[model samples]
Target: MARLFGTDGVRGEANTAITAELALDLAVAAAHVLGEAGEFAGHRPVAVVGTDGRASGEFLSAAVVAGLASAGVDVLDAGVLPTPAVAFLTADLGADLGVVLSASHNPMPDNGIKFFARGGHKLPDDVEDAIEARMREPWTRPTGAGVGRVRRLEDGGERYVTHLLDVLPHRLDGLHVVVDAANGASSVVSPEAFRRAGARVEVIGASPDGLNINDGVGSTHLEPLRDAVLAHGADLGIAHDGDADRCLAVDHRGEVVDGDQILSVLALALRERGDLRGDTVVATVMSNLGMLRAMDEQGVTVRQTGVGDRYVLEDMLAGGYALGGEQSGHVILLDHATTGDGVLTGLMLAARVAQTGRPLAELAGVMTRLPQVLVNVRGVDKDAVETHERVQADLAAAVDELGSEGRVLLRKSGTEPIVRVMVEAVDQERAQAVADRLADSVRTHLSLTG
Candidate 1:
């Protein structure tokens, strides 16, 4: 059988691959695994659970609560909140564990379950594997007296908003901001948080009907936000995914400002205030070369990690760095959050605009993004990309042709039978041509049937 956990969590089509049974089993197993680790040895274990605004999340959250309670763990239901909010509340409330039911940027049909250990930290691989292993073990049902209780956390959202407000360096009093909440977890809180921070806010993608989450909205689709920004003549716009753990922005000109530019802007802001720890920022391998060059010019060091926010977090923690994030806008400001907080990120970005009296376009201009092209070649043996002689030779030749002005990266998809071919250069035409040529080579050299 395949492993239940992916890079993020146990995620799949809700009610099918990730059914109620699976959610319950995972929760019971997690309680056992964490309990045995002495996380709940002295006192009764408390679990904080939250979910995005998905219809399926209602059932999943119920299943998780049942499982945790049956295993003698009290459940604090923080309903319809962002994943990061659950993480923060888990730590803030002194809960022993945290559970968030969300599929992030995935469509409405899909859902996931992510667990956080004490202190709001992502579970290590060993802990997750152990939870999986324990799922197959026999259950020890607790009696009525030993069973756990359930409660509601009514002020969880307010607490999170208060935290963001307190951490913000400047209020967005004079800014005109547009917010696209993707009709997901942040729909209610994101707009409210920004408005409370003093920005004149207009919102779209804020009306969710459960099934409409991430449909033609959010960070993945920038057109709606861009048009809204221009139509409203707003200073800028912010978009969040289904779970609101990350954010992407649009300038007043309606130009998209992606994660790379967001990172550059925040890094500079933190550095200016002497708050950038170790003068270093952690980023993923997928970050544009331009971001690194920009950091270098500003006397800031860029620490590159594998393509995941967790990897960036690991590097940041190891070096005591204060800021790190993925190119997809999942930024972690360790000073304020243990995980990425979309509301916090948007507030800080707008605060920068407010403080400097500079438009977001000018702030984002701190890094000039290089033209990038990515091709996904499917129906292939992705693992062979590194060792195949013909593919290696072709890739080497392409790298040589681009010289120091460009680069190529061929990586296997972790969860699919595909290989990603990415090329970046000074010109879009060259990047696309080089990427397509390498993709063709991958298909020819690594096809499974071949």
Candidate 2:
């Protein structure tokens, strides 16, 4: 059988692949695994739980709570909070584990379950595997007094907002900012954080009715945020995904600022304050060539990993680096957060804008994004993408042709029989042409049906 966990966590369509029974089983198993690992040696195991306010989350959260409590783990139910908030609460409250019921930026009908360890850190692969293995194993049931208790954590959002404010380097005294919450998890706390930080705040995609999240707003959809920023004449706009673990921005000129640009801006800001540890930042292999070039020119080093925030985080931790993130806006400021916190990222970005007296566009201007084109070629033997002779020759030719002014990357999809061909160049036309040629080569040489 395929592994239950993907790059982030176990996710699927609600009530189908991710059902209430599965959530319960996973929770119980996680508690058991952690308990056996001596995490609960001297005290009863405790867990912090939260959700993204999806209608399915109502039932899913209940199932998780039930599982944990029945397994003798006390539960602090933090209702309707972002994924990072749950992580923070887990550490703040001294809980042994944290569970977030969310599908992040997925469509409303999809949902997911992810866990955090004692310090609000994501579980390592070995631990996740152990939990999965223990899910169906027979175990003793806790009796009356031994059963864990559940309590509602009514101040979770407030506590999280306070933490964000404390981590902010500068106050947004005169900035007028617009926030797009994706109508998901950060609907309330995101705006409240900006307002308290002294920014004149306007909001859109904040009225989540459980079904409207990521419908036409949030980071995935920038049209609404751009229009709102232009209409309100805001200094900048911040967009958060469903569970608010990622953040992407829009400048006052109504131009969308991507994660690469955001990272460049933050890298400079942190460097200025000497807070960028070792003057190094971590990024994924898929990061734009522009970001890499900008960092090199600025005397900052960027370490590239595979295509996942977890890999980026792993690299950062190993090197004691202070900044890391993906192109998808999952920025991790290691000094303050154990996981990516969208609200914290927005506040830090705004603080930079306010402190330097430079517009977001000007700060983001440090890097000029090269035109990038990506082509997905399916019905191919994805595993042979690297070894196939003809495909390798075509890729090498494309790379040699692009030379110093551009780059090419061919990656096999982790979950599907597809190969992604990405090319970057000085011009869009050139990038697209190279990417198309490479993709055609992949299809012709590696076709499974052929």
Number of the top-ranking candidate, with TM-score as the measure: 1
lDDT of 2 by residue, 130-202 (tens): 9999997899999998999999999999999999999899999999999999999999999999999999999
lDDT of 2 at 8: 84
Q: After superposition, how far is residue 350 of candidate 1 from its true place, in Å?
A: 0.5
lDDT of each: 0.91, 0.93
- Lowest summed-lDDT stretch of 10 residues in model 1? 409-418
- The regions of model 2 sitting more than 4 angstroms off are 376-393, 413-419, 441-450
What lDDT tens digits, residue by residue, belong to model 1 across residues 192-300? 9999999999999988888989999999998999999999999999999999999999999999998889989999999999999888999988889889898999999
For candidate 1, the C-alpha RMSD (Å) to the true structure equals 1.5
Off by over 4 Å in 1: 387-389, 415-418, 448-450
Candidate 1, overall lDDT? 0.91
